[model samples]
Target: MTLDEDDRQRRLPAGRKAQLAAYVAETGQVTVSALAERFGVSIDTIRRDLDQLSADGVLVRTYGGAVSQSTLSRVDRAVDVRLKMEEREKEKIAVLAASLVEDGSIVMINGGTTTLAVARNLRNHRDLTVVTNSLLVPPALSPSAVRDVYVFGGAVRTLTLATIGPVSFRASGGSELDISCDLALIGVGAVSTAAGYTTSNLAEAAMMREMISRAARVAILADSSKFGRRLFAQVSELGGADYLVTDSTPPPDLLEALAENEVELITPDTREGAPEADQDPQ
Candidate 1:
């Protein structure tokens, strides 16, 4: 260590850990090596600090370092990272979902990687109007593919690339043409019978609730991984959704609750890709 750094560490041992926690709070996330370099401490000491902070629920540890506990509780992940996961399942779900809408329908899609996949699948429909809050969706829908595309304007969430805040809500407010959607295709971070449906952002949840209220029918597009998990923000109850489209069946209890709520469950048809049972080996 530099002589200046060593002297500073010696003078403020307790203060250093406090400052480390403060740094993590300010930056949202940090790496062990970066923390070590900043504090002029050994990497092992930084690791110990992170561990203690995590144990106290002050922060949550990642593979390299730590992030604020609140960030972890929200279950937020970057859109790029999420897009790469459950690729095949999302594609199949999107295709099946696209089939449900008529050519001339007006559809609303909420912001999520899976819903973005759904937006992409609708490109072939020439007579549809696609309304969305996702910044990523507009570029994906060419004018020739859909007759009209409407996007809600608001503050953009950098991580998810979706528009949120009060402005977006106002744009879609009231029972008017803006919010008069035939169907809504929504995606969520987690779902449970007890917690209902939840996403990572509160603003997004608020927008989703309004979208659900305005739409004639609401369909939740979720992968099997989202089932049984509950995140920080509740978007709606089990009864809010009219349909659930997924790759596989959820837990029996949740399924029972969904059925009781009259939510239609749609799963991929297994026969589409299965080889014939009696097929001979080459």
Candidate 2:
């Protein structure tokens, strides 16, 4: 029997409420500004929502934000949250980035939402040696029959849930990588023609910088939202990367800026029948 449309609209499932509770508890803090922006709701609506969430003990209200009261799992807090945000753009970038990997290659992948999508697409490739500091990548690639996943060890940053420290940097640097996959797929919080790639944390920037230096080829995976944006710390110059994979067709001015720095720009085709540029020549 079909339920009344208004009744269905007014009712939310218990599981969804629980999931929202869990999300608030894991994120550490959620500000009204962030909520309003993320959900496209008014600040007053977000405040009221936070008030209800706070009363449930999932979050504690602060002056302008709410703090999580429970510990968050790395997978739940970082990987899942990221996948839900900017999902379509990341998926397009991921499919494009994965097309770069061939069989029997050793590739380094940096930690981020976009890179995680790349890892998911790499599962079918045979005899791949995947090295990554992201806690999320291993599980996604683990079940693949042809790939070997290596999880780098270091202090895990709670925000990104990726390992970073002197140890991780040194280990990544010490490896002698093959030219076949001397390619590193990296992620950044923001990218600007002026500031290059930036991250919210300094240690993450250092780790990414090390990866960039060690790899023979560097490809950056970022969405259009990252364009012209700046974060807290600069990781590398825009010229440092060999290729930039993005979902949007960049503006002419921005395209000229990237081309001037010799950065090759690639955008993926959304339609099934559309042709992709061949990476390897026949």
TM-score of each: 0.67, 0.66
List runs of model 2 lying over 4 Å from the truth. Answer: 1-79, 145-147, 167-181, 269-282
RMSD of each: 9.4, 10.9
| Candidate 2: residue 237 lDDT (0-100) | 91
For residues 127-217, could you state the per-residue lDDT of candidate 2 as single tens digits?
Answer: 8888888888887673653456667678898767788864232337687444224689998888887898898788888888888887888
Residue 59 miss distance in model 1 (angstroms)? 22
Lowest lDDT sum, 10 consecutive residues, model 2, at 273-282
- Hey, what RMSD does candidate 1 come out at? 9.4
- Please give, for residues 1-282, the per-residue lDDT of candidate 1 as tens digits: 787875586347676877888888988879999998888789999898888877776777776787764454346676754664677788777876776677888888888888877777775577888888898888866466688887887889988899885423343456434347789888888889999999877899998888888789899889998899988899899899988888888999999999999999877753265221221221
For model 1, state the Cα shift of residue 10 in Å: 35
